[model samples]
Structures are given as C-alpha cells and as structure tokens.
Target: MSYPHHLGMTVLEAGPERTRVSLTVTPSGLNMHGSAHGGLIFSLADEAFALISNATAQAVAVETHLSFFRAARDGDQLVAVATPERVGRTLATYRVEVRRGAGGEVIALFLGTVSRREKPA
Candidate 1:
C-alpha cells in the first residue's frame, strides 16, 4: 500500500542531508480559530524529517519537537526546509525550519531524531 497521507501534503524535495517541502493553506485546513492547525504544521515538519532522515537509508523517527512562532492564514504558502544536524550509523538528527514563503516570515522551528533500521536479511 502506498503512504498517501504524506503524498497528499505535496512534499517537494527529498535528498541527502536535506529536504524541502511546501504546504498551501486552505479554508478546510484551518482550525476553529481560523488559523492553520498545529497538527498540520507538525505533519509538514514530520514529513520533511522523514524525507531527510531516510535519504541515505531507511530510518524511523524516535523523537520530535516543534515551536510555533507565528500563525499562518488561508492562502499562505508555507515552506519547510530540513537539514541534517547530526548523522551517525545508528542515529540521525535534523532541524526543520518552516516559514511563510510568500512573505518570508518564520512560522515554526522543529527538531527530529531518527534511528536507522537494518535491512532485512
């Protein structure tokens, strides 16, 4: 089965040591407060983490954390950029920065730690 959940979010780039992604805000994506939901932001960051972590090999997220600095509104084009902070044989860490691409404003910052999995013998 395909992992369509991540695909639906429109992740743009996946490569060694980095991943670039974007999410466009829509009416249906907003919360009761009329702002982009934290879950959405987290999902965006998590997707970036997954892409970057697995760039070299298969990996799994062991921990993740995010801090939101501003709210995103409908029609705002949000982009997330992930870069490797540390890469080891067993564990890897990445930093993701989410921003409003249209206005170049910072939206959120995230950190993710992933563990590499051995290939099945």
Candidate 2:
C-alpha cells in the first residue's frame, strides 16, 4: 500500500490544478502534547501537494514551508486542499491549506515548490 493509504489518508479529489485529501487523527499520530504531530500534518499537506503537482507533469518537490495556526487532536478529521500558485516551464508552486473537518478552522498552511523532470525519451 502507498504511504498515504497506510496513514489512513483519503484523496477526496484530484485534478491537474487542485487536489484534496483528508485524514482522521489516530492516537498513534499524536504528539507528546496530545495533539496531532506536526509531521503528520505536513504529510497530509504533502500528499495533496504531490497529487496536484504530478497531475500534469513529472515533478518532485524542491522545497516546502508549513505554518501551524491551530492544534488538532485525536478523532479530529483534517482536510488538505492544494492548488497551484504558479506553473512555469521547469518549476511550479503550490499552496496547501489544512483545515479541521471539511470546512472547519484552518490548522496549517503549506507552500511547496516542485521541479519538473524531463520526460523519458
């Protein structure tokens, strides 16, 4: 199984310009503070990022930045939505917003850049 599947993440939507992914927090995904680990949140955002970035081209993440605005705990469902900010010939930027539940409060924001790879001959 893919890593996102193993982590209980579900892709709600995927298109060339946008992608949405969701995850329900589990006990094992919690940090010492009883909230969801930052890494787990990052993973969720990255999953959406991966889907949107690769939908139109072969791409790999070159850099990423995430900022946490709130804490999520066990049983809290989180949704990440990724959309392209800019797409260039060789590089692209995407923005991901992770929120509590489907339309709940924003928990984190992630920005990622990807480098497109040349197609194999």
Q: What tens digits encode model 2's per-residue C-alpha lDDT throughout 1-121?
A: 9899989999999997779999999999999999999999999999999999988789999999999999999999999999999999899999999999888999999999999876565
lDDT of 1 by residue, 14-59 (tens): 8976688887888877899999989888888888888888877789
Candidate 1 overall Cα lDDT vs. reference?
0.84
Compare the candidates by TM-score and give the number of the best one.
2
Candidate 2 Cα misplacement greater than 4 A, ranges: 118-121
What global local distance difference test value does model 2 have? 0.95
lDDT of 2 at 52: 94
RMSD (CA, angstroms), candidate 1: 2.4
Q: What is the lDDT of residue 84 in candidate 2?
A: 92
